[model samples]
Target: MKINRCIAPLMISVILSVAGCSSSSKEDQVMNANLGAQALYDKARESMANGNFAAAADSLSALDSRFPFGPLSHQVQLDLVYSYYKSGKIDQTLATIDRFIRLNPNHADVDYAFYMRGLTNMEADNNLFQELVGIDTTDRDPSKSKQAFDDFRRLIQQYPDSKYAADARQRMVFIKNRLASYEISIARFYMRREAFIAAANRGRYVLEYYPDSDQLQQALEIMVECYDQLELTELRDNAMKTLKLNFPDSQFIS
Candidate 1:
């Protein structure tokens, strides 16, 4: 009877101790999860501030998965987009922006989302005809550049007073110059091949569409050359007159 009583007390103590330990472990796990989430968020912010975008992205991704719909979720989503952009993951950047836009169209930062999408595409431009045309079409697509320009334009149209408006205007100028240069290049190629009509038409198109382009002088000069080659005396004289009127001191005209 005495031994039985002793064994019973010892067994109860052991059982209680085990239960206490398990309870403590469960609490510790909860505390650790909360702390880990906080630590991850802090590390992500630090990495972003330090320009370690890849590390920040990884940390933020962990936080996102662990604490989905948590208090910091929205901020984490935006940070992920910025992180992808800073890390040079252009496609990811675009996709993230699209996702954000689609998810939160009325969010306060929606304009920024659009602006970032435009900026992403603009930065990824390859400036190669073959790459732009996908190797199947010999034609110069310019669609990527056009998409970027249209995006920026949409931001300006919808959010005229946005902080990105000035930047969008600057990007538009760049797009215009790029388009003008492409046209001028095609015109010169035609000129070299003695395709005078094609060359003149291309040059005229540039002059008509991109009057503010830096290539204006070169385009007019090409027109003058093209008309001269075709023996169109009136058109050649007219092109010369226009060239002189626009760029009297241009080296090409002189």
Candidate 2:
């Protein structure tokens, strides 16, 4: 009985191992059976031209898996990122971007990947429904916005003269404004709850980190009000003076 029990476990293990190998072999065979690298790339391009991003992604993924180091490898990775992004596969787009950036950091076109990373993260922060409904996202989590901002910042810093640098700078401005606006929203909420310290701190953060934001005036106003509430006369006067100097026509000037 003991011998039989040991043999049974051994046989089961052997069978499982064989099954795993067979599964992997099948996958390899399928990859091999696909069109040649060039043909597959052409197919993906055609699909992309037709606005069939899903089909293009499939073909490009298959090409990438079958020919990881082929002559078209770099182009395949770039195309895969674009197709995945167009297909709304944010995770796949990011994974491919990370892989490309990791493997080809010094490639001439790496800046495009960085730009696309920012664009993807920005897209992830919004949904079609939210756009259609005109929902207020200022109070929503800003983590994705922050990530996008970092991506664009890195692109600008590393590829200052890249073709996409101008657009990246523009997007960075927008992201800073959005982030500052979100902070102001939080500060306003804290003010409503009589959390003067928290409100003033948020305003201070915007002033310190996002001075170029369009919400600078609002942040200064909030800081002044919060400091007044907390009886911080010096801080209130400083904030008020800054607000007045910057925004002479501001309603809060008085």
Candidate 3:
């Protein structure tokens, strides 16, 4: 019995030693993963700063695989988003932003995340004025501009104290002006097609809904022309009076 007891104690010691080794192995693995992630992160940053966005994306992706939940994982993910954006991979950039927003809605830098998404979409706009001037052959997709403007507006509304809020507000103004101009363009197209009532209504809608728009004067001028073509003399006079009252110096008024 004593020998059995001695063997039992020896067995316990062996088991404990095995358990301790297993625990140490796990800890070592964690440490190695963290180190690997940090090394990859450093390399990725260097590559990005040197304008090697593709290399930076690959390095960061490697870190993601090696240390999926490691300490630098979040930062690597964010950097990956920026790398994809800078590389002009629009779909990947948008997908990464969506992932970040879904995963870390309450994160402190969530505002910046949303801001980055807005900036990405905004930068993709090739200027509505250029499109309007017939310099670009692309079909006008106001939807993209609308998406960017809405995203920026959401950022400003949700994170008013964010550093990007002011810039977002300014971008919103540009977007609004473009939107109003597009409306005026459509109004003019309707007038040219002898759809005078449709053109008059569109112009009136712009003046009413977008009074602060930079295109307000042009919209009012379109309204005056449309109303006169429709023989709505009273409406034409009213539009002229309103345009003169609001923009006496506007070239459209003269």
**Which candidate leads the pack in lDDT?**
2
Deviating ranges (above 4 Å) for candidate 2 = 1-32
How close is each model in CA RMSD to the real structure? 15.7, 8.9, 17.4
For all candidates, the clash counts are 0, 0, 0
Off by over 4 Å in 3: 1-35, 127-139, 249-254
- Candidate 3 lDDT over 1-254, as tens digits, reads 45587589899999999999889757645554566666778878998999989768777766877887888878888998899888887778888889989998998888888888887887676665786787732236667778888889889889999999998889888887777777887887788899988988878888887789887888888888888887889999999999899879867666
Local distance difference test values of all predictions, in order: 0.83, 0.92, 0.81
**Could you give candidate 1's per-residue lDDT for residues 1-254 as a string of tens digits?**
45687699999999999999889757644544566777878888998999989878877777877897888877888898889889988888888788888888888878888898888887776545666676532235567777898899999999999999999999999988887888888887897799999999988998899999888988889988888889999988888898999999966575
What's the ranking of the predictions by lDDT, best on top? 2, 1, 3
Candidate 1 Cα misplacement greater than 4 A, ranges:
1-38, 65-68, 126-142, 251-254
Best by TM-score: 2
Clashing pairs in 2: none
lDDT of 2: 0.92
Model 1 CA RMSD to the hidden true structure, in angstroms = 15.7
Question: For each candidate, what TM-score against the reference?
Answer: 0.72, 0.86, 0.77
Error of 3 at 7 (Å): 84
